[model samples]
Target: MSHRQVMKVLSGLLLGMFVAILSSTVVSTALPRIVADLGGGQSAYTWVVTASLLSMTASTPLWGKLADLAGKKVLVQSAIVIFVLASAGAGLAQSTGVLIAFRAVQGIGVGGLVALAQVILASIVPPRERGRYSGYFGATFAVATVGGPLLGGVITDTPGLGWRWCFYVGVPFAVIALAVLQRTLRLPAARRPDVRVDWLGALLVAASVCLLLVWVTLAGDSYAWASWQTAAMVGGSVLLGLLFVRVEARAADPVMPLWLFRNRTIALSALASLFVGVAMFGSTVFLSQYFQLARGESPTTAGVMTIPMIAGLFASSTVSGLVITRTGRWKAWLVAGGTLVTAGLGLLGTMRYDTAYWQLAVYMGLLGTGIGMMMQNLVLATQNQVSAEQLGAASSSVTFFRSLGGAVGVSALGAALSGRVSHYVEEGMAAAGIPQSGAAGGGAIPDLGSLPGPVRQVIESSYGHGIADVHLYAAPLALVALLLVLAVREVPLGRRAVGE
Candidate 1:
């Protein structure tokens, strides 16, 4: 390809990626209002996010496989088209179910966008130069991470253009990405002879993941942890998981190669990605809610408060990527990132309704820096370890686990918050000489504006306490992640494309 053509393809890839990330991140700040407007409860809110994560996680390998079979350009454009349709459908949905179903569709598109972007980038950039461009990907990740909440908050708070616009807003950008890619992006095709998709493997993997997600989502809420529902979900998940392992081993082209797990580097990276996903996605998804409910910030203001986190992420990720490229050291950053994430979560666990804003900012910054250092480097380290042909499988596999971890964490944490909030609300109301009956409503906590000032303060305080507990509860998981990072052997950085 000509230099101009290469640049055009790269630009289109980045733009498509930005829109994909933007759609996911931007919904964070707007979720509370969106759920309320759609007449749903906390579980609905959790599902809204989980459904997307589930679809995204499950579809990633499929997209990668498709890219290997079909042409990259065709798959990427098709993903964008599907994403546009889903976004419009989600924006126009009248009910939570419709919104969730469409969001799932959108997630599938996001899966394609994410996986194929890496694939195409690898086709153009060499391993050494890839880091410099990986910096761009990191920046794009940070921007979308920051912009999603900020934009979501603004759209949610704005009159006559509420949370729905957050979904609608991406439609035009995705359309543009599709048109640009169609016109400008060209690449060598992966026309492997006798290529066939492993559809059964895909179905088994999806079923297994869905069962597991549902189990996590339902545990400690719809049933006791030891109840029949739990047993069924947990049992069914285990069975399907084993079945998937068997299927992958036997399939000519498995969605996930069972052999990939044998590589220590790939295994470690996947584990690290899982923890990072839990810490990064699980924590950030709830920040907007905490800021609005606990700190009493407006949605827009909540988005603004997150600047320290985004800034920390961008700075650390860029700096670390550069230093790793120069020095060929990566494992230390993984260990450090995990440690920082642990510390950040612990700091956040100390938060209260009246906690100083500066303190929160500091905690957020620490968390962001840790995540920045760890997330992409995990992929980088894995890429360095695997062969070129294994690139698609390895990359998609890491992404798949990371996303699955996020979905699991969100469901578990969301359920915890729901229960904790109920307990605190009850305690606060009783302490204030109000009837316990006042806290009996089974949906989302009512809007603070609707309550009397004193009652509202109590509600806010309860939410703050509950959110702090959520962080505290999740801290051990981050610490465990930190320990896992420590176990990863330091691997020298190589001149290998991530999707090698």
Candidate 2:
């Protein structure tokens, strides 16, 4: 394909990608308001985010397998339709239950989009020249990641417009992406007739993940972690996972092929992504709450505060991509990124509600820079190690694990934060000689603007210290990721002819 042709296809691909990324992050700022309006506790707040991630993680491998057998254009269009309908449904939801259901449906489509965009790109662009295009993709992602939160905040804060518009806003973007793909995307080959899907493997994978997430999300809040409920869920999940391994080993077309792990690059990248998932998604998802509940910032102001992180992401991804293209070196960037992530998370762990804004900005910048350098390069590195035949499976496997890590990290960290806040609130109440009955229950998520002055201080301080505690827990995970990155052997850049 010529440069102009690549741009035409990229225009649609980028827009579709923006929708996926935007849908996930936009809700972060609006979540507190959503939970308050819908009347849920802290666990519900985490489940809203975790539900989407769970569905996305569970479906990614199936979507990747489908992409290989199904026509890419048709699959892409189907995903867009699914996403648009789900988004509309989510916007219309009157209850947390309904919203979570819609978000899960929306995640099915997101899984497809996330896996397909890169798989298709790998098909069209040779790995050597892919750096330039990948940079464009990375920049588009950075913009969406930053823009979604602000946009969601603005929409939610706008009187009479409300938080529902955050869900509705993706409709127009989805429509545009569908039209662009219809007009511009061209496939290289016809769909094969002999392809078969490993339905049992898909089922097993979903069952295991769902069971485990159920335990992870509900154990501490709904029941004791050491009870029969935990035994049932954890044991059931392990058995299902084992069955999935057995099924995949024998299936003609495994949704998640077990053999892919035999490749060193794939194994390393997937492991690194798993740890990065815990570090990146676990810590950052709470920033909106930090600004609002801790610092007492409005929704829009909280959105704006995230710009420092975005700036670092944009600068590092753009600069590192261009440099890698010129020098044909990427491993050094990965190592530096892992190191930065560990350092950044470690620094962020010490912050509390009263921590200065400038210090927060610096810490976020370092973390963002680390993510920018690492995320895409890992995928790029994995792609370089395989033949084109394995691209879909290989790429999607990495993504699936990363999403898994995110789902687990979010659920676990949210629970941890909630527990810490409850403890702190109890301590504060004791020191101030306030009756225990007057203190808000630990699970309560209240509107900051409506609280009495003294009560608000207690809530904010609890949140501040609690969120920081989660960061402290996550820093070592980032260090684990850094260690994994050091183990990844550098593979040579692809010298395959461009536009093959």
Candidate 3:
């Protein structure tokens, strides 16, 4: 394909990517309001986010395997249709349970987009030239990450629109992407005469991930972390995971090929992606709450305040991609990005509700820059190592682990946040000689406007301290990602396609 042709197809692909990302991020700013409206507490808030991640994580590898067997274009279009339908359902949901169910279905489509986008790109673009195109992906991600919250915040704050519009806003963009993709995408068909999907492996993988995520989300709040329930859930998850590995090893067409892990670059990149997910998704998901709950900012104002982080992500991703394309070297950027992520998380750990906005901006910028440099490049590095035949499996495998990390991280961090906040609020109330039955009691998220000044201050401080602790816990994971990246061998990117 000519450069013009590639760009033409990429327009549709990036738009699809944009829609997928937008759907997830658009709800971040409005989640507080949505949960409160539905009469849910912290666990419900965490589950709302985790439901999608859990489903996306579980389905990613299956989508990738299917892409390798089926044609990419049809699969991409199918995913868009599923996403749009689910988004509509999510918008009309009257309860958190209904919304979560729709979000889970929406994740099945996201799994396709997230895996197939890179797989399709790898099919057309040579690794040496892929960096330039990846910059476009980074830009789309930045825009969606920036715009989703801002748009959601506006929609939520708007009197008539409410939080439901956050789900609806992405539908039109998706419809346009579907039309453009049909017109522009021209890929060689991928059909195997004896294609056999390992359905058992897929099921086992999904069951295992679901069990683990449920355990993590419910462990501290619903039951003691060391109780028999924990043992049962963890044991069940491990058994299912082992069964999945066994099933994959013997399956005709494994959803995730275990042999791929033998490749050094793919293994290290996958591992790095795992830790990156923990730090990136775990910490960033809560920033909206931090602004609204801790700092007492309105939703729209909170969204606007996140611009520095997005700006830094945009700059680093664009610049690093250009440099990598020119030089055909990517290891330095990975190392630098890892360093910055660790530093950023560490710095952010010191922040409280009363911390200066400038300090918060600086810290956020560093974290975003690091993520931008690392995220797509990890896939780029992994894709560079595999042949076209294995592109889907290898690409989605890394994404699966990353998403798995994110699900676990969010669940664990959220649980910790809930417990810490409750503890802090209790101490503050006691110190102030306030009753335990105040608005902040019962572990429910409080309405700041409804509380007295002293009580509100206590709630704010609790959230600030608890959130900071989450960042502190995540910093070590970023450091682990840095080590993994450093260990990755730098291979010179070739101009020719894989297996050429």
| lDDT tens digits by residue: candidate 1, 1-500 | 44365666788788888898898888888887788788888888888988888999999988877776778898998888888889889989899999999999999998888788766666666555555556667888999889989998889888999888898888888878878888888776777778688898889889988988888777777788888988888899889889988988998988888898888878878887887788887788777778887767888888889989999898888888788767778888888998999899999999988999999999999999998888877777776666666667777888888888888888888888888888888888878887765553324745766777767777788878887887887778888878777877776766644444
Question: Could you tell me every candidate's TM-score relative to the true structure?
Answer: 0.95, 0.97, 0.99
CA displacement after TM-score superposition, residue 30 of candidate 3 (Å): 0.3
In the order shown, the candidates' Cα RMSDs to the true structure are 2.0, 1.4, 1.0
State candidate 2's TM-score.
0.97
Better of 2 and 3 by lDDT: 3
Per-residue lDDT tens digits of candidate 3, residues 188-294?
78899698988899999999989998898888888999999999999999999999999999988899999999999999999999999887788768888899999
- Misplaced by over 4 Å in model 1 are 1-7, 440-442, 496-500
For all candidates in order, the CA lDDT equals: 0.82, 0.85, 0.91
Give the candidate number with the greatest TM-score.
3
- What clash pairs does model 3 have? none
User: So what's the TM-score on candidate 1?
Assistant: 0.95
Give the distance in Å from residue 105's predicted Cα in candidate 2 to where it truly belongs: 0.6
Residue 173, candidate 3: alpha-carbon lDDT? 97
Whole-model lDDT, candidate 1? 0.82
lDDT of 2 by residue, 391-496 (tens): 7888888889888989999999988888899999888777767777756655978777777787778888889888888888888988888888899888767757
**Minimal lDDT window, size 10, model 2:** 491-500
Better TM-score candidate (1, 2): 2
